[model samples]
Target: MLHQPAAPVGKDPAQQYKMRLGVWMVIAYSLFYGGFVAINLLKPLLMEKTVLAGLNLATVYGFALIIVALLQALVYDAMCRAQEHKLSDQKIAGEVR
Candidate 1:
């Protein structure tokens, strides 16, 4: 006999959406990091090129990555807050019915 996969184990729709959003953010960050690694490994000299008065390409790229990470965190926080609000509203609505 074949076994069926268990249901989401009390996971509600909002919870699932939040999980998916988190995974997507992780994937985005990973890909951004991978690009930097690839560039460094493929052409170390490329990173040494001056982007600013003294800053090199590598330094600029690294800083950009940090900014992106912070932005992602902010977005994630907002999304989670919205999801929590929505889920709470749903619960309250259900209770009233």
Candidate 2:
């Protein structure tokens, strides 16, 4: 009879962090999308004529999205740095073994 190797037990911290990050990304995306939809739905009612610089609703939305994307990128970068630090600490302490 051939015996297969058993699956490894216990969760790795790095893997756990990755999973958490994925969940957070999903949540963030959902919220972003939902907010976008809500704003679009209420745009006509909320939109106001701007005399300053002559910016329209569409332009405002575009700028808002660009800002959101930049902020999200920064947030993701910080999260990645935190995860890297955690992994490095674990490596130094020999927790990965």
| C-alpha RMSD by candidate, in order | 5.2, 6.2
TM-score of model 2 (CA atoms): 0.58
lDDT scores for all predictions?
Answer: 0.91, 0.71
Residues 1-97 of candidate 1: C-alpha lDDT, one tens digit per residue:
2454565345465888889999999999999999999999999999999998799999999999999999999999999999988998999999999
Give the local distance difference test score of model 1: 0.91
lDDT of 2 at 59: 66
Off by over 4 Å in 2: 1-13, 48-54, 95-97
Tens-place lDDT per residue, model 2, 70-91, is: 8877887788778878887978
- What TM-score fits each model? 0.78, 0.58
Candidate 1 Cα misplacement greater than 4 A, ranges: 1-13, 52-54
Clash pairs for candidate 1: none
**Which is the leading candidate under lDDT?**
1
